[model samples]
Target chain A: MEVAEKTWGLMKKKVLVIEDNADHQAIIKSSLVSRNYLVVCADNPSDALHYLLDEKIDLIILDLWLPEMDGLSFLKDLKNVPEFSEIPVIVTSGTFGSEYDILKLNGYGVREFFMKPYDPAELVETVGSLLKKTVD
Target chain B: MFYYTDPKRGRDMKRQKRVFLIGLLAAILGYLWELYLIHSHPPFIFVKIKPTWWMQWVILFAAWRIGVFISGLWKTQPTASSQKENDREEELKYLSRIYQDLSNSLRLEKGKFEAVLRGAPDGIFTLDEVGRINFWNESMEKLTELKKEDVLGKPYEDVLTFYSTGKLVGFEQGTMEGSSSSEPRQAVNFFSFNGDQSLSFLEIDAEVSGGKEFPAAVSVSTLKSPDKKNTEQIIITVKDMTAQKEIEKLREEMIAMITHDLRSPLSSILGYAGLLQNPKLCVSEEDRQKFLTALIRSGKGMLLLINNLLETARLGDGKVPVISEPVKIKMVLEEVAENLLALAKGKNLSLSVEAKDNLWADSDKDKLHEILTNLVSNAIKFSRSGEAVKITAFEKAQEVVISISDSGPGIRAEEKEYLFEKFSKIKKQGSTTGLGLYIVKKLTDKINGRIVVESQEAIGSTFTLKLPASKKASSSVQLSLVGSR
Candidate 1:
């Protein structure tokens, strides 16, 4: 799952990936960080909440399943805190079905939903496009 | 001369016969007396027939005296003393009837007792207070392979001698291990009886015909007299418990097999998953594919093993229940919170819950309960002294989020590779089967929800689940007070 479309614009984009699986987290970080996009990681949402406060996070990548709190609920909880609502969350999960559509998640204030064993390239491209829009 | 028989017929016949003889004598007496009177002193003057006539007079006088005795006897009735004699005989008959009834019931009871003992399926025998084998049942005869005639009425230990480890069963030489079982360890030894635990071996008259030994559960009980007045006998019942012992052995064998089989596959999956998750390893695409394929295969194998060890239904049935009802999410969380508080307190941990007043989730109550319970229990398992575990839930836009946070030795970032994988071990987790998290994940997937983990080393960990909130229960639905009841 590597991205063929690598960005040439050398701007440091800071992102926090709230994920529990180390391998998937490693794969996501490796695929994104190599392209000059700095990734901050938290194993759960509560820690994700910390990085949101401490850093200038451009975007957030959240795993749907986590130990401390689920991604959607954390999204909902994060939305209640006015400042975190401005941050767009890219939800990634190992689970799928009709109930897990990206549009359906958008209704929960999620910007995107990625199914795992996901293509790391597509994720990077999607992150690039969203970050570009926010920067503009 | 006639006998006066008991019946009145014999007495009348004898009386009539004697009267007829008397009548004949009277006629002769009338004529003879006239002649004798003429001879003695003539009616007008002395008419002498001679001195021989004197003998005739003596015979006549003797007949008259016997007749007077018979007449007197005919006038008397049965005496009062004789009536008393009849009454005495009636009393004797009534006494005999009562004696018959008492003796008959006693005999019947004795017959029943003997029959029960004789027909018993298990070996049974009775010993007198002195330990003499007075009674032996049919089963005992069959068990010993000796006829009742041979063993009964003889000293039990001598007649039906059995040796276990070359020591007598009832009279063990010195309570040796291999010898006959020890005497009752309970208070029964204080009395003459042996408690049911005193088991022994009974070999057929092994001296005469060598026979295999069968273990017998022996119960020696004191038999009371029929009136329950006194104890004079001891009865022993022996049941062959060989089948029960065999079943117990089989169960131990099954447990051994489960441990050996389940552990190997678990470690196999853990090792393979660990290897596959390494991102920096330089390898050919084919090799990576091979390892990935092996990892999946081994992972399935581990799942099959665990599925067999525990209930296999949890995986299959978990996905099928779409029972979408507006369940009060706070009620379940509160119930789980109250229940696990004691467990947390046992380790000096504080467990608390925070939830909105009437938040509801569109989900199956049972599945959600299982999911919540597994998460909460896992929290307590990894927690230690003075750690506080918190459960918080709230409805966020279109979904309700529940979180169980535990101040425990949290997972390392590296080991998180397979945190929720089936049979994966967590840091500092002692020997648990590790099926809890895997099941929890599956249940979350089934309910169309998702779980997330947040942890830091030495800080703590929290597991949160986001389930869709039921629109029908929008707001203002009050869940009944659920905890501290």
Candidate 2:
């Protein structure tokens, strides 16, 4: 009776994907959706920021190379805002970045980094762990 | 002649003649004055001696000797002057011979240079500093299909008269309309480099004769004067790299296709494995078999792709040997038809074979099977639903011909040239790698066979392969005919 009350009351958290590739976005969407996590997609940082403003986003999955703005700038701007600062961002890139860029992104409170073609299973586990930490 | 023609030398000769005349005139005047003075005033009678008969004889002898001495002086003056003139003429003749020799050697050297330039297989054109075509060779003539008279003095940037407005034609200008693999315009930038610059090479896909654009590797080297001090001309060597570039592009495209093709099957295999690994999922024995079967089909598709790739690599080195033994062509066609039945059924295609009894040819058994399989498979892949593909084999003289006819949309007339070329992609929707016909052509060459394709758009295509008949098969057939008679 207690489990039913808790499950029915709280809705699934929304995760926004900032990816440009159609196949990668589809794969991310299907994987997350199959795991019962609400997913949203955007091709760039600016559109993803709009999602963060309109919807109650629990976490952000970011890609570095974007049309309008990059993931680093988005992270910097999001952190400056008092309301969106708490949401953790995960950086995923097709291009393997240098050590300095990874260290710098980590200092920005990024939860984790994944290089593409990443294992979909590991991605799910990481997302689950980060969300669990956020709830706690 | 030179002394007369030259004003300076003529003036000296005239001055010398005038001096000689004045000396002669003075001597005559002095002689006449002496005669007049002696006649007017006679010498003292005591000092003057009267002439006798013996005195007359001595005077005569002295006169004769003096005459001889004067004649000798005259002869020496004339002979010395004539000798000097003769020496001058000989010197002039020697100089003229040297001049002739130098000119002949220069002409021979020029001929040798011209021959070397024209002998080059690549287009060699020497451009002046101002971009004028100072020298054009025979290869350039062939490459541009422009005659020497037309292009020798023309400018590098030509304005074609084809367009009424006189559109300018530049070599290998860059635009985004080219293929995705097009490089930046750095190669042609060598032409625009500043004065007396270091040598550079610029390769481009130039539109040559007949508006056909082919890739060419151009190297620009500055031709300096004989002393190597000043830049004389720019020598541009244009090597037509069309064939090499085509192979490279095909290789890249094939790689991309292989990656994409491999990914689809890999995705299926991964999905199946993921499902099987799931502890929450339950599977039936029948479902397992179906999954296994799907995996096997995907694996076979990958295997066929790998096989085609291996064949391409093998054929690239040299021709593989063919076993010249008697083999029945009918069996090969039947085998190909049997294999393509499932594929034809999927597309609802009618596949049929017409062959003479035991129609044999001297060819490799396995290679013949492979050739039939490729042709029949291609036919089925291209044919629409309910359309029929026919395989027919016959014998004419010492050759055996097997023709595969398809009801697919046939190849266009223009596309036939590239049909057997490596990496040629005529159809967009091909299941196999695009090197099918190229490999078939190579294999046919191994058995000294010939292959030809006859097609009309919307009508269909017929591919024919002809190989020499084995002697044994012909002799056996002749023996059977005699026995029947």
Candidate 3:
């Protein structure tokens, strides 16, 4: 059942990769490309915000840390934005377990948290499953 | 000598001396008569009599003999009396010595015990059976300001001293009852130590010895000194811990600052990623893809950095609860590799997994995941394009080894030593937070795992994680390793 759901959900799914490092960026893009995701890239918050205002984003794979504006702030702003209020944001970062930070992000309504250098297949599967749930 | 000081004994000695001289004269007369009789004896009795000079000499000799006999008897009399007196004096001396020893030992023992009690970070005191002060150490003195002399003999209610918030504590009825042996009751009382300094706070501990058999509410403790046999006594150890409590408050405040620092950037990246992913923005296809991709990658990267910071801080604070479970090595490796596969492929690197067998070890699942992911991710990060990264998991003897091999330039010998240290990054200048490997090491240690990093300059590096099959095994191995190295 999970396999069938994942296979079906993989069709025409969108994945957003938020990273500041060029090398990291290229790696994430390639991975999503292999998984057949319509991958979107952003180096910082400003460019990411511009894209969010324009695209029909299915799922947001948010990074906890970013240049200038951070992932959490970006999330909070997104929650406030009328068009993006209903979107699900999965918070991904290597920085986790800070009692203070986790609470803040949790308060801002981040659905899930994955540490960096994350699992690529799991990310794909999770993104696919989440999109399927939204479709259902 | 003592008799000399007694007038009655002196008078008796004088009377005895007079009797001795009279006896000497009578003995001399008797001796002269015997000589006279001997000279006048018949032929069968064949006796001879001495001349006047001889008689006189005999009398003198008899007198000397009498004198010696009298002196001897006199000497015996004094010795007999002295034996009785000496026996009494010896007993008294023994008692005095025992008293001195007891006092010295009590002082020394109390001194050492009191030193610990006073130095304890908690407040402590002892109340006698009657709730009186039988033994009060320096700490009690400083805490109550009532000297041992003042409170030693006073009843519990009368001399009971307690300083709460720098004020003398008042005792209520039933506070001084000695506990019974069968049902020992420790009248636990919590009080706040009021002081001008920041040491004002409530302390919690039971009154060790209740008012009954174990009276004195001595925080029931033992005193083991070489000179003194092991003895159970009431020893209460308390620290103000108020400073510690204050430190906790300060920690919470500092945590707030850290949260602010963490959330500001994390939220922005997430928010911007959400904004860019919205289709209503009508952005160009190429630009939109680029923007969304950056948003997600940065968001995940930022999240990872935050996770590392949190994990390290939690482990450092000794607040991380370790839940040991049967953890499958393949599961973790598979998960980590699958996650990093995209990144490796993006660099055109071959990310292979050599963990075919399902190797299981008892560990904290989350912590193990953290260690494995960090090692593999680091391997991928430092590797050049077209290079290969290998992750292998297998069991060797009693240990489970999870090794990550990379084709990147191996860590420098000098740098390898400090590679796992916090904020020590080989990537000199970049957006990297430098907490990845350090977090991994910390998490691994928490789960009682050994981490070995083998690197050669310009060659590939391999990070090996060895964890015991059981949590107990891990701890023992870790302890031995620590002791040996």
Candidate 4:
């Protein structure tokens, strides 16, 4: 375990957050950064896609509602790509809480779903566990 | 056994008894006359025939009695032909009464049916089996602007036309059974008149008189005979769907907007609060202050949205009482400016108030303050950084004119009309609930004030409020100024 921890320390896991709300973006970034994880913020899906093209994102935190293209469509497009399909995704929504939406997200291989006003501590814990499983 | 006696039969019996008594008396008199003739004549032939002649008199009496009895029987009994005539007369009378009752009830039922049709809210009409308009109600007359007399006995297709997807729908007799090869089956598929009592509702655009069209929901039910083989009549009810459709659309949009607006602020508040509560994370003093400020701001925004929603509901009832008093305009402006100073500073915008000393207006103090606060905050929210939001007040004739001007993106010409409408936001910027201007307009109207807008696109916009001035205060000020002069 000590050796594993050392190896984890050698390589930091990178997470991408796609959120339109500036305040939410700042809060999520601060929480993840405090946990020794690298965080990249994008205000929209297009910018998030640009980040994905430029970096190897290990995990993703997505907001369902967006300005240009909705998060579901972006997720679909991402899953179609061979490289990004394996990356774990955590979905967050402020307004969408229907069972149908959750089922669709589950079908798209989402690792976690969180409603707005969710605990940041829990989110950080989940992200850490998901990254650890990937490393193992 | 009970026996029944007729008065006419009793009269004939008494007459028959009197005839028999008379015949007996005549027989006795004839026998005496025969004896006297035999005694007086004393001839040989008369003596021999005396007894026999008396017998002949008796026979004559018997014959007379028999004839009277036969005549009495004939007078008492009725003949077959006369009895048949009497029975026919009674049957005719009974049939006439039944006919009278049936016609009366039918007339009453018709009257009731007509009254119900006329009182109905939806346009109701009935068509004959041949698709001619047989009955049109008052509502139908109002809906189509055509009188009953004009439409009665006319083909329904000629008067009313329906369209679906911009294609004309044909409505002919028996079209519900499916259309022919020459007709478009899709157009007539909406109708389901299978001689059943079931009703089918269809949404279509109905063209009225003068080629005016509106969305309508039409329901049709067929009346069939007992055998259900033929449709006797078709009852159609039309309801105008234009208002209902618009309301449904508005309700959907309102729900979406309200959910987005409410959750946005709530997310921010929760996020900031969560950050502040984290024990392990090292939050700098300045960062802590910023986080706390954001929390407060989000809380205030949520409260304002809730209050605006409640205010809209209250104002819908039109029961906001106005307490008119002499309110100092300058003091109101200063208070509004003080309240919105933080908001303006956040955006690096300056708020300035220009009002003469003791400038007074006769209005509701609380309402006036609320109006000014909303207008000033809106100006601050729209204005760019380093720009100025100016509030000026002056007296024009007997009215006080107050204008709030902002160096922001001015509204376009077409957009100005819907500036103060509920849920109408010209530009979706920041986290505005779009109820601010609507509340402002309602508050202004409640105080009997008029609002006007002056704007040039890409420059700035000014909202001017004209209110009645304080008469007594102005008169006193005029007197004091004259005395000083």
Best by DockQ: 4
Q: Write the per-residue lDDT of candidate 2 for residues A1-136, one digit (tens) a residue.
A: 9999887654697899987644456556656766778999987776887898899999888876554566788888888998998998888765544687787787788859976556666677788899888887
TM-score winner:
4
lDDT of 1 by residue, A25-133 (tens): 6556766765677988887777888888898888899876576555778877887888878887788765443553555577777757775555566687799898878
The collision pairs in model 2 are none
- Residue B80 lDDT, candidate 2, scale 0-100: 77
- Return the lDDT, model 4, position B474: 38
- DockQ of every model listed? 0.02, 0.04, 0.05, 0.31
DockQ of 2: 0.04
Comparing 1 with 2 on lDDT, the higher-scoring candidate is 2
Error of 2 at B177 (Å): 18
For candidate 4, lDDT tens digit of each residue in A5-84?
89756497889999977678877888888888899999788899999999989999999877667799999999999999
Model 3 ranges off by over 4 Å: A1-20, A23-136, B1-287, B345-348, B470-485
Cα lDDT for residue B245, candidate 4: 92
Could you tell me which 10 consecutive residues in candidate 2 chain A have the lowest summed lDDT? A21-30
Report the number of the highest-lDDT candidate: 4
What's the DockQ of model 4?
A: 0.31
Tell me the tens digit of each residue's lDDT in model 4 across B51-107.
565576665666556654554454444458756875786699789999999999999
- Specify the CAPRI tier of model 2: incorrect
> After superposition on all CA atoms, what RMSD does each candidate show versus the true structure?
25.2, 14.0, 17.6, 13.6
CAPRI tier for the interface of model 3: incorrect
Ordered from best to worst DockQ, the candidate numbers read: 4, 3, 2, 1
